[model samples]
Target: MKAFKTSKRVLSSLIAIMLLVMSCQSFLAADGDEKKPLNIPEITLENLQVRGGSTTYLVDNPPYSETAPTMRDFDFGPGSDNMQDAYIVYNYGNEVMIESLTLVGWWPKDQAVKNISLEYFKDGQWVTAQENIEVPWQTSGGTEEEVEITLTEPVTTMKFRVKINSAYHSWSDKICMHLMRPNGYIVTEFKPLTDAIAQAEKLVSQVLIGNKDGEFSQDAVDSLNAVTNEIKEKLDAGLVTADDIPVMIEQIETAIEEFTSSQNPMENAPAAEAENLTVSLGNTAYLTDRQISTGMTVSFTDSENPAYLTLDFSGKNLNATGLTLLASSSDKFTLNMSAEAEIDGVWTEIAAGTDFNYRCDVQGTEGHKITFDSCTASKFRIKINSSTAESFTVYEILWDGLYDTDTSAMDNLINKANSIIKNPASSDYPDLLDILKIVLSPAENQETSILANQGKIDTITQLLSEAISAFDGLAQYEKGDVNHSGSLEIEDVTLIQKHIVKLLQETDFFDEYLADVDNDGVISIKDATSIQIAISSK
Candidate 1:
């Protein structure tokens, strides 16, 4: 009984194979042997419709000629209004693979359609297949030039639209095309195979094999390639029939699924380290010192000329990533502020606020912050203006970025060493004095060179720190000695007072670490009082 069942199954398989072969042979013998130009019948008003553009000229009897093709805007003589946007759509009633298009222009020079765009409907949407096609204009009483455009690849669709973009004459906007012929094959029977081939080609072009995002594994790539090559071989040999198409499409789809499953997720990859560059205020210049308080907080009153503040990064380029404006007002005020960046010697406005309303009593009125993509600039300016006379106090104008040549660490170490050397106590020990001078001499002379070389800065900072630590006498300087003058004196108290009041410039040399006598990690009136108390006790 088992043997009989096996023989029956084998016979059924053989019968199926024979049926498939016979069907392919019959199809090839019929019209599948070679491709021929489609025999599209004459397009009349019944088959053609105006999908887009003017519909006035699409009537059965136009104003110019009743026999002329309806896909035209007839010229009403010179100085007539031209048709602006016009599109003629043709429904072929069945799927066809379009290969080329032939356009026959009118004989008149200025009345003929000069340019056109072709679009086809596919998958429920109209897609532009070709554009900017120039149809040659025929001079009066001259031979007409028929322009034939061969498509890069055949498009399969049931409907198409022709857009008349321009006319030959500038004076008249009238566009006329005598006739249009599309050439290709009706591909209703081979639609499945063509669609599958297109999908496989798209997959092959998009798939990648690498250790990155959206990349597939090598095994997945190899599997896809094997299946694609097999399908290509069968297609080229003309052995692929209707029955083979389903299996080939299934194999390609399965390969694509496997490739997608093998893709590496972004979360599994190592994350990139972010830059931790230090932030500091740049050198600022005021347009006018009148009615302005240039202290820790900047304040300006409304004047005839708008007040402006410019921040220069000391000739160093910065990739500015963010900005902040800290301001407070007792009364309600509205002002206009424009932020400009000096790019290539020109001040270009990047951001502006037409009515920047601010009041201390209002919620969310504390500050304004703006973050942008990295912008490289060495200078930036802010201009403030208002119609009503009002006083505006800005506590801080912060710009966040990474400098091109970051010498922040080196600069900090240099300031520390300079503070130690400036102290009168270090002069007592000649050896310590000579060592400090020698370590800072190279930095003083080749400042620009050291700024460019990060390795050199690291080496010098390490050496200088080690030398200062090795000498115990140089490291034990008295606290509150802002000038490093070796002792607690009135001069130290005065310097602290000046710093607290913002009387000193940023470029002014002073030791902030030592001046913070209160050890609260801040320089305030308490630190100055502490130094005065210590001096009075002595």
Candidate 2:
């Protein structure tokens, strides 16, 4: 069986445009606040046109009738009766959650599709959105009949497929299918502006691989590199923002058009091959001096059970969408949590505390995810405060960020990213020979490069994406929150003394959770002594 080809010039163009738009937009999106439906462009996947089963005649038929059954432009053949499987995917430029899909076919009741499965891409793989989708065999029907398959949850992806099991031999027109992204207010803000550039730079490296391997012409490389540099110019001036993400994605659609266009078609670009990114935090990361984690060096502010943790990304800046923390308390309690980052050498508040109501049944000993101010920061600090409690325990902190944990992989990626910043998108960089090396090398061989010794790769597409996120793979109670309030004041000392003298209920919030200040997981006078120690030493 033969595979369909992708346009050669479009991909590099897509990479360049996405970055240019990202370089020109805002930093924050209020979740789902924008009221108007965004003008997200539809992505075209050149890789998905292929053969899966035998005896299935693949036919590219024109529109069966006028109004696209479900509004899809084209349809494929139902093929001969035995033709069991055929798959196709459409790339919507931006990542979108599709809740429903519509399919239209003009076939005899016998030839109509009987069963189907719908899948969407998430993380790094495809997940079944609707399995065994039953399609009532349509009697000879007009081309206007539409079949809608509803999904359980909104599946986010740029590519999705419908695999038809069996169909009566189609005599004439094929089926046209339409996929929809919920037309709701979609906030374009995702990652920090600079991170978007990094992602764009990552895509640039991929195109360079195609270029070195003769998959892309020099003209394509020159054109893309020029756009990449313009993006860098914007970043250098700190002129970019997060609101550009949608436009950045739209730019990718533009590139795809040029990529798939006959102008300079690459020989073997895979259909639906690009793996979306979900960059994670790495292992070498650590908290302040590893101090509080050890339970040895305990410090307190003027408040009781003060819950706070500080982290330094060092070379890896934290540009997270949201953060999650693990808080420890023997009993349930509420605390106001806040996050701050050091930007421009001064501390700035990013996420204001919107205290979570801690219901013992639902939240358990763990606190929930928190939304904070989003920005790239060298150092980030999280503080949790309580009005009624004095001491609590914080178990862990997690930051969601970009791919490449092994600093070396990031270093290689950074090298490529820097070239984008250093050069123009239209100029050619002869030094990008490293792109082919990064693409073709086995991931386990680090002697050559850091990314070479990591996650999944070998194929050009996987290599590009796995290269970024290949390194796969936090707490808390605000401790000393003794009175069940998040502060370390003399009032906590009074509560602890009272608890020990049989004046207080053992199950009360303060006595149960914060009184165990030493964090032995048990209540004891020693905890009171330790809280005093943390106080006097202050």
Candidate 3:
């Protein structure tokens, strides 16, 4: 009885195996002769939408009279039952050669696929290239397992046949294929103004998300946020507004390209250190008579060049008979003397490229002292160097603490002096004198005149400010009204005519302000005629 039971069990197992084999054969032959007719119609696509960059395509069976061809229905059972078979055809549209191809899907469970075969159609005939390209069914499917079959020569059609020599575990769906092509684009960079607007709009969209009903719409909020951030970052950092966007983008892109090309960072580092500027100090021709007895050196060398250097003297009335080059040849010396004196005494040697500077010390004083001696040297640069009583390394340093002043004052003074020299009675000497008095006076005593002079300054400032404002306002108005009729370009020149008539209505010559190009304030036929002339010409 035990022997009979064993035999029966073996028979049952054999019968099950036979049934599985039949099922596998049926799956492989599903698209072959012994199957119901597939009613799905052939479909083709033309003029596909391509963004000219990274794009992907998937073979999606469209909803139609039939469910369409799918690999899910093909069942490849456990154990070596029957051969598994599947075929795929791809056509290269517009003669574009396929750079790369990949087939992807979940792995089969039971066993691995024995091989894959490829065929190509060319010269009006089909040709089989490979019959056994191995693919492991138990392994995961991705780009890693992609079979790179290089044709070397161009072909119009590619056919792949996946064959299962042994039964493997089933997969939920058939594998999908992807063909990759490098990106191409015509517009490499964006327009500056347009890019700014787009960025603003994007920010607005993010900030106003889900706040559709708020006072500021998503777009407005984004625009304001973007513009505000841009102003704060760029303007504060001092970036110029008129720079071209493409130029900047190209620069950044070029940097990226260079980094990618070189790949080695240290290769771009500085090869060697740079040389420093040489600077030193030397004695004046004649050390002050006081300096002679002080047991102190009147000269020094600027140890740290490109560094600030200063010299100071205080206490007892310091006096020097004369200043001499003092034997050492050097290029650095600047001095401020209270009394006119000789620079560098006899027998002292002056070096090449060396310079001597002298000025009066009036820092906290009412005025400066006159020079007592002559500065000896064939050549020397003499600068005011400021009346402040501080040793400054650079000339610009002396102007640092000064309050903002009208640089035009100097020009005005010079002009006034010239006018006085030319025809003194015809010019306004009092006004010129008043302006100069404020300029030449010591800083401590400048308060009263400054306060009294504010109104006159304001009048002049206002005239200039108003003229500029008017011109800018008119330009902006015209820009906004691009239609250019008097409105923009669309409507009649109503505003223009009104302004013209207003100009004509002005009567006072000196007091009333109008487009009095002649400065003779009365707005008469001349102003009206000027407007008329401009309009006619336009």
Tens digit per residue, CA lDDT, model 2, 1-538 = 1111212222223322332353244434367433333233333323223222211111111332343312223334544433444555543333444556544443334345556667765554667776665565344654333344556665655456665555454454244332222222223333333344454454445442343322445565456556556655553343445665557545644553453231233222111100111112211121111112211112234455544566665544546656665544445667677777778888778888768655543454464677764588766666655423334444345565532334333334433332232323212434343553455344334324433312332233355444333321101234565543445777777777777787866554453444556655456778777878888987
In candidate 3, stretches whose alpha carbon ends up further than 4 angstroms from where it belongs are: 1-85, 93-100, 108-114, 136-167, 170-538
Better of 1 and 3 by lDDT: 1
| Candidate achieving the largest lDDT | 1
Q: Write the per-residue lDDT of candidate 3 for residues 381-447, one digit (tens) a residue.
A: 2122222212222211110011123423332333222222233332344654444334333222333
> Which candidate has the top score in TM-score?
1
If the candidates were sorted by their TM-score against the true structure, best first, what order would they fall in? 1, 2, 3
My TM-score estimates for the predictions, one after another, are 0.29, 0.27, 0.17
Deviation from truth (RMSD, Å), model 1: 22.6
The superposed Cα distance between candidate 1 and the true structure at residue 287, in angstroms, equals 40
- Each candidate: RMSD: 22.6, 31.2, 32.2
Q: Rank the candidates by lDDT, best first.
A: 1, 2, 3
